[model samples]
Target: MNCLIIDDEPLAIDIIAAHCAHHSDIKVIDTCCMAMEAFQALHQYEIDLIFLDINMPVVSGLNFLKSLKEPPAVILTTAYPDYALEGYELNVVDYLLKPISLERFNMAIDKVRQRLALPKPAVADTASVRNLSAAQSGPVKNFIFIKSNGKLVKLDFSDIHYIEGMKDYLKIYTHDKVHVIHQTMKNMEEQLPESLFRRVHKSYIIALNAIKQIDGNCIETEKGGVPLSSTYRDALLKTIEK
Candidate 1:
């Protein structure tokens, strides 16, 4: 994928570029010190991914992302971890805390590759159906692998109470802890078997077996109540009735 690095720090840009060099599939098209320059680069090149810093002169990276009608995949690079939620809400591919390690940077790039592999919604039929069927009937996947703290962590599927989407990542709540992973909601939804999980909101997919009750537009799980959107409520009800 053609990539862009947008950061005011020369060292930061160089670090990212060096990481990209390790991967043959990724190429650094250009580096911009400010958002405006990055904006111009976006118009000039068919950029597929971006390593963006949250703070920059004149125009912040977030504002520049907001300005795009159809933005390329973005991985936010910032020193502060506080902006993670906001960055995810913007549909970024991943959030990388500054002074990023090669391992962490590689993990973020893996997410970008996965996103690029996904077919657009309009043409996603064949792959979606195949993945759903495999998930449901292919030797029950009791566990799933999630990237956390620069490594792959395995969690039992049954241990999950619910999953909340924060743009490009998922907050997976379990009985004992919450695991945050860089992934899109749609991608996660498809990987989960429909027999055990249900998408109840634009941002949530719950493990049906973990649900205790349904009240109004919410599902009560052992962890807590998760909102059920009007768009997905009826389908969830229909699934339960079956």
Candidate 2:
């Protein structure tokens, strides 16, 4: 994927470019520090994606995106979490916060790949899929690959105690460590198997088996207590009952 980095800060541009280097499929076509320069670059190159900062001098990133007649897939890179909703309203591929981690950057690129219908890097084991299907009566495969620290980390569903939502990112707490990935709660909810995980609050999703106890509005896990919102309380109870 040919990507353009548009941000006023040179450091921010350098960071994003460095991350993009890790993915062989992604190429940094050019970098633009101002909106006008980016506008020209977009016209000149067949750009596939953009990492844009919202707080640019003169023409803001949001406004520049609006000005495009046919904007390419965009991942908003900004320090302000408040612009997340507005960025979504503009149909950005993903919203990434400042000090973007390599893991987070990879997750955003995955979204762009999906949006463009590009083939994903081989992560799933096809042999496992066939083997599980042939068995016909065993537990479903329950592991996922998440980008962490510039590499793909395989995590078993059983290891995850809970997931904490942080605006455009998610903090996945497992028995050993915490992994931060760029993903929305809604996306994570859909991706996770409903039978194994349940949304107990607006900002939390707990592994059903990991919940040790429920008290008032809290659900206790091995690591810590997670909030159980009234909105999801009844549904959670019903899920547990079954």
Give the top-scoring candidate (TM-score): 2
lDDT of 1 at 23: 61
Tens-digit lDDT string for candidate 2 (32-151) = 989999989998999999999999899999999999989999999997899999999999999998767767888999999999999876543645433423343145557766667756
TM-score of each: 0.49, 0.51
CA shift at 36, candidate 1, in angstroms? 0.9
- For residues 1-242, what per-residue lDDT tens digits would candidate 1 score against the true structure? 88899998664664576566556567678899998898889989999999999988899889988898899999999878988888989999999986677678878888887899932223235555444344433455566666677675777778889999997778999999998876667656645667788999999999989889999988998899999899998898898888
lDDT agreement with native, every candidate:
0.80, 0.82
Root-mean-square deviation of candidate 1: 13.5
Note the residue pairs that clash in candidate 2.
Answer: none
The runs of at least 3 residues in candidate 2 whose Cα sits more than 4 Å from the true structure, single-residue gaps closed, are 122-242
State the TM-score for model 2. 0.51
